[model samples]
Target chain A: MLNIIWPVFIIISFMYAIVTGRVNEVNNGIFEAVSDAVELSITFLGTICLWNGIMEIVKKTTLIQKLTKLLNPLVKVLFPDLKHSQKAKEEISMNMVANLLGLGNAATPLGLKAMKTMQEENCKKDTLSNAMAMFIVLNTASLQLIPTNVIAIRTSLNSANPTQIILPVWGATIIAAVVGVLATKLITKKIK
Target chain B: MVNYISAAAIPFIILGIIIYGLIEKNKVYDSFLEGAKEGIEIVFKMFPTLVGIFLAVGALRSSGVIELIVKIVEPMTKMLSIPSEIMPLALLRPISGSASMAVAVDIMKNYGVDTFVGLITSTIMGSTETTFYTIAIYTSAVGIKKTRGILVAALLADFAGMIASVIIWRIMSTSFC
Candidate 1:
């Protein structure tokens, strides 16, 4: 995955550059141009570690168990196969929570972990099962309540009312998120 | 690295491990070590994706392409009744924070940071993502096969937020700040 990530990034970047006439800059300072690859792990380490701890606590306390119990019936409609696993249910909810806070930085690994975890039981080996499709849909159409990271960036840059866009952002996230899950559920069901 | 974030997490983690060990009849420390080992692998996998996306954003700013986009978008920006002065930040706000920060600083240097333009640009900043960077990294990490609907919806969301920031600031300034 790491190997694939960079190659894909390079190709996308190269295409963007060529289209935007940034190819000239790349040729001139190839090293300088590629400077962003420098801190591949250090900064995200802090957030990842922090969120991982949060996730661990959430799982340990059975907040996840309770949460799964609550979301399960609704989830049964969207992800009928995942109707029962405490672990899978916890992972999905946490991943969704991270997205709600606009923690893309954190939500990502959790989402990936959930994907791998779901694959572990090997029950969905035959096809793109409801649970698998539901996860993909949820991750893509995550509902954000706070837009925390974006708000932080705005405030740091001196915006007068960083919270100004809160409502619209929330509205969009909710709509997309609900639509995303339901649409995927329906689409997958029809295909099956 | 794990020590700090795990500090508050220690109590829960220790409890979880102990419970697991007792249930499964294994050593608590052994279970914990296994968890830590798995955590490290997860972080390592995220590397090149984050690095490449951030770098590409840096390049966009340095190359002045972002500024050009801002200029092109300025008229539609004004039509929305948003201050045209914020056009740069409106465009940059979604792509990169540091770059947008510098641009905001430049706007502040010219407009005195407390003015409507500065305030609104900053507000817009607080409200958006580094769009391309997020799309690149997140979609890659999650692997979305089809992005058309997501792309259109996200951009519309961004546009809605951008407009909302301006209107809110305008109303807020006249009434509150």
Candidate 2:
């Protein structure tokens, strides 16, 4: 998907910039984006390490088993094909927990770990597996109880009630997750 | 009250995990160090992909292309009662996290955060993920080249979330007023 999307973005941007004589802005945009990426990575490094370190402890202890047990039923329902790969299932459960808590930073590392584990079970190395496709959709259609970032942004702007949108957000989030999962299941089934 | 709990949640989780490690007689410090090291490796692996995505998104935003597209789509969205002010955010929400965030902030600033437009923008931001960024990082980490049906499904989900946000806010704003 990114294969086509990435080039199309670049082509459109350049074409529009040239026609509008905004070539200099495009140059600055590229450079600014590179620096922003680096800055984001640097900021991400700390939280990633903190959570991954914490998760490592979770893994060594029986905490993973307990946590996995809590989420096992949901995991089984979502990715039944993953039953044979307990490791993948455990990682996915952890990722789901992080996401549910609205911990975006923590979720990414756990999610990447899950993806890596699922990749091991892929028969065709380069192609995305059914489980992998479902997992991506789940992450993209994130379902969280509270939207910390949006709330924080609102508070910073001195809103009368920062978290007023939380109820509406929950409604939208659940709808997104349901649609995303159903779409993935239906499409992948058709392909097979 | 909500803010306090959200802030305390992480610390409590960390403390719980460590205590569990101690009770289980696990090497908590060593394990954390090992995991932290792996975390660094993961970030390094993701940097190249991040750069590519950021570059494309940056160019798209800076070129005024998104704004142009939003203008073009404004009529169709209006027919559905979707505010044209949020069209840029609805479009960018799936593409880039920071870009959508900036747009959301812009909306909040232009229209008071307590207004209908601001409420809808906040809801959309909360519900939808940065689909392109999430997909690129997850797929590239495991070296999966063919993304197949993931993009379509993810984007469809994002669209649903955005529309849902608009509808819910419209209903709320009307009833409350």
Candidate 3:
């Protein structure tokens, strides 16, 4: 999907720039984007490292096990294929934990690990399983309890009530998540 | 208020994790270093993908494609009660995080940060994930070539988030007013 989408973006943008006579602007944007990507990755590096480190500690202490146990009922319902797979369950729960805390960068590795684990259990190599589809929906909808980054940005911009959007964000994300999961379940059921 | 509590949450989580690690008598420091090293490697692996998407998004925005998109979508957005000014952010939210952040920042700058449009943009930004980026990095990490059904589901979620943000903000703003 991305294979087609990524190139199409570049092609469309280039064509649009030429037609609009904004080639110079596109050139500058490309240069700035390169630097921006590097800077953005570096920023992610710091936060990812810190959160992963904390997660590592949590894992070593078996806190993840406890979390998995606590989340098992919900997780099992969402990912029935992972019902007996303790490792996948642990990784998925940890990923959900990171996501709920709004640690996206930290959640990615855990999510990737969970996906890889689930893939290993699947009979088919390339095709996604129903559980994997559900996981993707849940992760992407990502019902965040604390939108730390958004609030931080609003605060930096000097909003009088930076966190005023918190309740609305939570409400919207929950709705998105519920809708996503329902859609995934219905679609996967029909396909099966 | 909620802001103060949320702000303190991260530190509280860190402290709790550390305390639990100590109680469990784990080699917390060594484990942390190992995880941090792994995190760095993951960041490096994601760098090229980030560069490709960022440049495309940057060009798309700078070349006025996004603005053109906004113009085209203006009527639909108005009918949906979403401000036309935030159309670009809604469109970009599912594609790239930084790009959408830039749009949200721009909206907050042009409109007062506390205004209805600004609040909706912020809420939308917070609620939605970058679906394309997440799918790309995650599927590649797992070496999955065929991403069946996830894309549509994720995009649906993004759409839901966008509409919900606008609706939720409208209700909340009305109550406040």
Per-residue C-alpha lDDT of model 2 across residues A53-125, encoded as one tens digit per residue: 8777766775434655798899899998897998999899888877876657668999999998998889989
**Proportion of true inter-chain contacts also present in candidate 1:** 0.08
What DockQ does each listed candidate score?
0.10, 0.47, 0.50
- Winning candidate number (TM-score): 3
| Model 3, span B37-113: residue lDDT tens | 87788668767766776677778888989788778988887888778888767776887766567557656756778
TM-score of chain A of each: 0.58, 0.66, 0.68
Better of 2 and 3 by lDDT: 2
Q: What docking grade does candidate 3 earn?
A: medium
Candidate 1 clash pair list: A154-B125, A154-B126, A159-B122, A159-B123, B94-B130, B94-B131
Candidate 1 vs candidate 3: which has greater DockQ?
3
True contacts kept of each: 0.08, 0.81, 0.75
Please give, for residues A12-74, the per-residue lDDT of candidate 3 as tens digits: 999999998999999998998788767656766776566567667765665544655677779
Q: Each model's TM-score? A: 0.46, 0.68, 0.71
DockQ category of candidate 1: incorrect
DockQ rank, highest first?
A: 3, 2, 1
Candidate 1 chain B, which ten residues in sequence have the lowest lDDT sum?
Answer: B1-10
Worst 10 residues of 3 chain A by lDDT: A59-68
From the highest lDDT down, the ranking of the candidates is 2, 3, 1
